[model samples]
Target: MKPVLLFLVSTAWTLTGAQYYYQGLMDYLENRLLAIEDRMQFWHEQSHRYHTELKDFKKLTTEAMDALSKEHSLLFKDLEGASVRVDRVEREMDYVESQTSPRACANKADKVVEQGAWGLEESRGEEEEEKDWEEVQSKVSDCVEILSGIRSVKILKRVGSPKGMWTRDPRSSKVYVFNGTSGDSIYQFNSVRDFSSSLGVSSSREIRLPSEFSGTGSSVYNGYLYYIQQEDETDVQVVRFDLMTGMVTDIAMFPVESHALVYSLNPETVADLAADNEGLWLLYAASDNEPNIHLAKMDPDTLDIEQIWDTRCPRENAEAAFVVCGTVYVVYNTRLASRSRVQCLFDVNDMIVSEEAPLLYFPRRYGAHASLKYNPEEKQLYGWDDGYQIIYRLTMKRKLLV
Candidate 1:
């Protein structure tokens, strides 16, 4: 009986131990499952945030593209308006060319002769005859002469920028050299002889200007420096600066089409300031579409416009131009730099006929002229070609006018 009771006790103890082991394994699995569910819930929230950010970025990109499209539309409209203006200018130019034909000029000359004969019969006084003689002499002095040819070319010195201007004042012995298209300083030499030699910067006097110049179109006259000042992108102002006082004496705003360059070859020249026997002149293209150059007579002292003339000289291949007396001689060259020639001219005094105009060609030189400044007293053209300062001596003859 004792042996059977011991066996029953052993069997019950083994069963109790197996049941406790199974309960512990079940509790561990429940805790692991809870941790996994928490991780999945966090991942879902992060995915929602990423989706919202992507949508915001897409909205911003669309807004930027819309703004860019609007700007492009406005730019296209401006281009179209400019095109229309160009077409209108072309039509007006055609009409003017028809009127200035050779036949029309001949008819106008016949009427002028009849008027002159009628006036001769009515006039009878000595004073009137003296006045008539003086008038004839005055007219002859004002560009009744045309350029026969270029007599000689003297290369003074090679200095400064490859494209710059160096000239002597017609009224004085002072030589002024500008290094670039725009600058506030000017190199002044006492005489032409001094400029020809390599004196360096120490010997030359530097004149500091109050305002900066915009283009290569600057000239010295009667101890004053005249230059173009770009007030804005479109508006232009001519400033007359006194060399002695180093002050801006005068500023005159002139109408110029800055959209197109004055000289296509030398774009740095917005408006060329030229001096001749008749006084100061401004050469520029007024209309954006009109490639023809326009000439304006300006008062040296007051910077006032005396008169304006459309030279009808094409600006396509023109490099530089100079005024002799009252006639404009436009020098032209190829884009690759060839022998420059005076292909077109305009006489403000109406003394030169198209048929009688001389086609003067220049001797082959370094390159195109950056600027051609005429010295009335010396009767020479001070030109800046490539980097060489050159002087062109001109031979003149009486113009055969209608």
Candidate 2:
């Protein structure tokens, strides 16, 4: 019994010591947790501060974009008004020039029609005058002089419908004509030969289409049409209409207030699409609020889209008026009065043939986008001048027939 009593004393001492030790450990742990909490609070404050700064920067960017967009809109309106006034001036010029030119160049058949046959003859006495006029049209160095008159007419019309409206793919064909108003009309055209023909052109059955959002542009691809629909007062939605499937899907939405970015949105994945045989290329640029350029290659078969390139112009003054072969030509105006720039020879590898160096340049945009087009089949290019849209044969005169 005495031995057991001694054991109890030792056990009691050990337990008492252990209790104090545990209390000390608990206090240490509590203090450590408090310190950790304080550090976390500091980090949270810093994080909130950075987030605030980021938001401010984004707000500034948005404001800048908004101001630019509004300013550009006003500028376009003024330009349009000026363009109308120029039309009157052109009328006066026409009245003056009409008094002369009793005989001029021949027609498409190389036979004289309006000008008469005798006027087409090469006169030795007037050879120098004819030679000079022809030289201005043919020589590369003379493009500016030839295009000078054209620039005056175009600077005013740049605000209206594209003077250089062109289709990229050659597969387009004339479908049935429909009578409808622009904004109130919903029009659908089919590219299919058989399906479209099945719907008789003179039929009484009427299909009504709705007006798509206007401010955003539209594109036509193989078997599909894509455009942006204004979702609300604050957002825009990208929608695609598949001709084969007869399905409409909203692929992406850009909220004007919450988010502002520029990227490509297509119905199907086109990552594997190579630029060589693909059909229908669509290029769009938005400069004012969102300074972005999108280059998309669309597949004719599956209504698929492949976005190959994206570029940013924060200042929002550049416009890619036209694309030929694999090159993109941009016309830009700086903030400085009457100073403009042409960004040419742009090559985006994914947009066209890979490993190719595309040489392109701004021809002359007296005050607006330059109008130039290239025809691969004919190996020719066309440029619009004041009163004439002139054709240029890119291939040498010797090998043109090929």
Q: Against the hidden reference, what TM-scores do the models get? A: 0.66, 0.34
Question: Whole-model lDDT, candidate 2?
Answer: 0.39
lDDT of 1 by residue, 13-80 (tens): 88888888888888889888989989988888888899899899889999989998999999999989
Highest-scoring model, lDDT: 1
Q: Candidate 1, residue 27: CA error in Å?
A: 72
Off by over 4 Å in 2: 1-169, 175-208, 233-235, 242-308, 312-315, 321-327, 334-345, 350-402
Show model 1 residue runs off by greater than 4 Å. 1-143, 400-402
Local error of candidate 1 at 284, Å? 0.8
Worst 10 residues of 2 by lDDT: 142-151
Clashing pairs for predicted structure model 2, backbone only: 150-386, 186-209, 345-360
Top candidate on TM-score is 1
Q: Provide the RMSD of all predictions against the true structure, rounded to 1 decimal.
A: 13.7, 21.3
CA lDDT of every candidate? 0.78, 0.39
TM-score of 2: 0.34
